[model samples]
Target: MPEAHGTDEVSDARPGPIRVVIADDHALYRQGMAIVVELDGAAVVVGQAGNGGEVVDLCARLHPDVVLMDVRMPVVGGIEATSRLHAADPRIRILMLTMSDDESDLFEAIKAGASGYLLKDLPGEEVADAIRRVHDGQAIIPPGMAATLLQEFSRLSQAGSVPEGPEPTTLTDREVEVLRHVARGMVNREVADALGIAENTVKNHVRSILEKLHLHSRVEAAVYAHQQRLVPPDA
Candidate 1:
């Protein structure tokens, strides 16, 4: 199962509270989670679900901005649900909220299409912050997990599983700079600040990068950046 954790802050340049849906088999826990999300004031709960199927139904119906999903549920599991939801709507962010910290779960969650994974024991404040960060297009991986993820990417690269994308020549000089920061796990605002550009400009660059590269989320862009050596491996 997934749980909550922290990510870098997003630029407040984006307006409005992020829309969310909470999914968990336990009614009380689900309700409590809804309360926490609402109390945080950064997100509004648009729906709730008790299983993976219900989550897909709610997401299709409501088109929420994010889904706070738990991994363990009857009928379907969070990983499957996340994969389904992501395939259906890549724009909808999915954050896994469960108690499992097993590396295998983490690896599967990423493969299953989760934008981020968190332990259920994450602090309420950090959870709220992570919602905003994920909504703002940042990939949320715990500090320690990042190394493991990177190592996995290396293994995949060695196995020749990573796709050979467009040549780096396709990106503008500015976009290359932005990708460097993004691959470093910097939020849009951070990229903007690093490149001394406006936040919206950074967003534009990100969009262009995704379009030119045919990638979906910032997480994919980050991984692609590494695999393509857009940024130095040691960095």
Candidate 2:
């Protein structure tokens, strides 16, 4: 069961709200989640998919900013779909929003290029917040798995298997610090507070980090941070 601590209503002042695609094997669950996800008008469900294949096709035709994917489905699975979608368009953020809490599923999803993994039983508001957060370019790993992810990242870093991207030296010291916080899953506001800077300043630094690193979102930046050994890959 899911919880809802806060009211669902929210204000989205952006010219266009976050575009989302919900892919799940269960129709009823999808229907219910769709309501919660769009309750505040912060996100719009541009498409609903019964499986990973449908999502891939939908994405090919209708681009969405975030994808709420299920781990297990017929014809294709979320992990494989994530890989295909990422290969097709690295800009789309794939989040494994499933019922599975298995460590393998969690690790595999990230390996497949998913920005985050979340259980369906989280609060409704939390779910909504996640859609917005990932859309804003921040990673969202489950709390239980953060430490383990860091360990694996460290192991991979030591093994020299992390993917190659812009070197950390390409970014200034502050941008690198901001990237470090982002890899640790800190939002702009949180990062600002930590660094004793304004939120807008943090946002600027983040934008610069993306541009300099040739990355699309904070999720990718988190991967970069780990590739450069910045963070455990975070909160």
Candidate 3:
């Protein structure tokens, strides 16, 4: 793992590498992550911070492409940190990396502007890939978590915490079909294969879906699809 720290080395570095910041309370884990993310040569660890406060500072100075944040920390938690950093700069992609699967944390992370929520148990390679995907503007909710997230949203809606929005009537039937596949955690290529359509067509459908629903990313679209019950309840 690269022992290099300091935003100076990373801040002025050219834009080729997907600059990353690994924020975890554990020193060992931060070192491990620095190694794993750079293994593929697609990303480089620009900085490491042990707490949320430091993360915010590093992000301000380094301006990384993605931040791997832990939920639990001494001074500030990941959710609050993500909220602050995201509010400051909406473009910085924050991916929550934690051991907790608590629905509350997951929902809160999403609410705080996280691009993705990933369990720490995921393989390092998967984690690296997730960072890249998030940087590329894709949302990375694990398959198991997706259903639970929908359930959480349903409960919140039932409690009237989430204001009801008008149904998205603008989406065509095929777009709706594509949405269901995406909500079920299928990528664009996967959705295209399942629907027997071209990948570019699926991309167009996704773009249209996001635009029609006024959604930002596929993660939000998936959540919207579930909240509207666009797919079978049993699904």
Candidate 4:
């Protein structure tokens, strides 16, 4: 049986333990994830589902803060489940936790409104950390996965004809500089010092970049930039 924590009623609560629903076809993996979330005192696995249909139903009933979803399932896959959940409530954040790091899976999940895409191979601690980050409205993508995502984006852009119209808003000069450093895999502090700016200022710019692009995280922004050929593929 799943453990239950006290449900406190506080409006200003410190974003109470991130409530999560784990959805995976494998029962063992589902239980493993549940254990990980519970181990982290700040996260709670409120429910579990084995298929896409169950995922959608649980989302409406439980309203979990995060969904640790799998890429493929029996009735419905993670991509379709994520879409259904997001359509029902755009505020719900979905995180794809899968074993496959396929570029197509990553792209489809992102387009379906996934706030984070992480591999199941990640340590339980890392998984917990990612859950918190996504709960805080940040997107998470593992290192190297960004490269695959960018490569796929480039292929799509090259194949399709560009539409003649106003382009999506571009990042500001300063924002571009920050993103350039980010694409190089520099952390926030490194970016701040390198750019001779405060860390908080760098963070603000990052937030702005995400908003402008309708992206969820720095990783996504970096990949998007690469897709647009904003930064050299080799660089």
Candidate 5:
């Protein structure tokens, strides 16, 4: 087992690396994560915290570009830590790394300001990719989890729980086209190339769509599109 580093800060102020912190209670998992993150050569593990309280403290101190937070922890837990961190600085992007697929956990994490949720069993490379994507302001949900998200949305809608504010304006024709591709799980680059537009343009459209629809992430947007039948199942 790799030696567990104490709660001191680890800084990587290098120009290119995406600064990150891993917050998992398990020591072995923390060591494994450090290796996985460093393998990318573009991300540096700035700190490691063993519980949610440490997670909040490390995040407040390190101010990493991304935080790989484990959902189940003794002190505060990932959901509460994420909420506190976001409340402190809304710009802090949190990508939940967990083992469970419980729908309640997924929904709560999202509600707590987690930008992305991914299972722990994902490949190391995929986890690295998710970190990059989330740092770039994209929401990440593991494949096959979209259906779960949709079911949650349906439940909320049935409970007469409208979104926090009034319903946002509808999408434009071109935005709808972009959303259709998004609903099919196409990333921004894929959607842009498919539409013959720049990737940045696709990003803009997605941001606008999220704002207009008052949705949280691409997963939510895709689920909403499906719930409203904007993009049919066979489309």
Candidate 6:
């Protein structure tokens, strides 16, 4: 039973900062991370947990906008926790912030429905900015790891595990337009610029696309679009 200690007493649903829940096995690291994430006021740590079950329980109650989850934790582990949380609510964004560079962990995190996978060696400011991007529906995978993900995708394709038709989707033309850009790894700002729409409008479209497709993150959306052959053949 992890406790939500040393955090602001803000309401669970707020308009100010992005509500966040930090879950890691280490208390010192979790506390230090909370400080860094809240330093610029772009995000707030509404709760803290040390294990998967605790974070699951906290997310159930706190309903944080984003979860900064670790890959490996005792009791429940991060992958299982992410799967459970994503199953429960695809709207809550989850980011894997860990020291593990294992490609399998990266694939599992994304497969378990995490919105983003990031390493711990990044600067604190960049980490904080990642929270913002994840909150705004962008997938943040480091460059080196992006290639790892591509390799994984290629492996899956070579294994003949990828379905030719995948599953049926009900995305509209505009949503298809947006999904293609997302699958191409375009952020919301870029998508908005390409489509000649407001950035916030692109955000709304992304939210709608996620909700309609029952997808969690832009990464998942990207995968979905690829399976549907929505992007260019080169993509």
Over 4 Å off, model 3: 1-15, 100-104, 164-167, 170-174, 184-186, 193-195
lDDT of 6 by residue, 71-172 (tens): 999999999999999899777888897775554788878788777676777678788877876675566677556656755764675577644432535767
Could you report the Cα RMSD, in angstroms, for every candidate shown? 3.9, 5.0, 6.6, 6.5, 6.9, 6.7
User: Candidate 4 or 5, higher lDDT?
Assistant: 5
> Of the candidates shown, which would achieve the greatest lDDT relative to the real structure?
1
RMSD of 6: 6.7
What residue pairs clash in candidate 6, if any at all? none
Candidate 3 lDDT tens digits, 178-209: 98997776777889899999988988888778
Clashes by residue pair, model 4 = none
> Compared with the true structure, what per-residue lDDT tens digits does model 1 show for residues 109-157?
8778787876677777778888887887666777667667767766787
**Model 4, residue 17: what's the lDDT?**
83
lDDT score for residue 110 of model 2:
75
Q: What is the lDDT of residue 157 in candidate 1?
A: 71
lDDT of 3: 0.77
Q: Is candidate 3 or candidate 6 better by lDDT?
A: 3
Residue runs of model 1 more than 4 Å from their true location after superposition: 1-17, 100-102, 184-204, 231-233
Task: List the global CA lDDT of all models.
Answer: 0.79, 0.76, 0.77, 0.73, 0.74, 0.75
Pairs with steric clashes in candidate 5: none
Better of 2 and 5 by lDDT: 2
lDDT of 5: 0.74
TM-score of 1: 0.80
In candidate 6, stretches whose alpha carbon ends up further than 4 angstroms from where it belongs are 1-14, 100-102, 157-182, 186-212, 229-234
- Tens digit per residue, CA lDDT, model 2, 114-160: 87877888888889987786776566766666656666755676688
- Sorting all predicted structures by lDDT, with the top scorer first, yields 1, 3, 2, 6, 5, 4
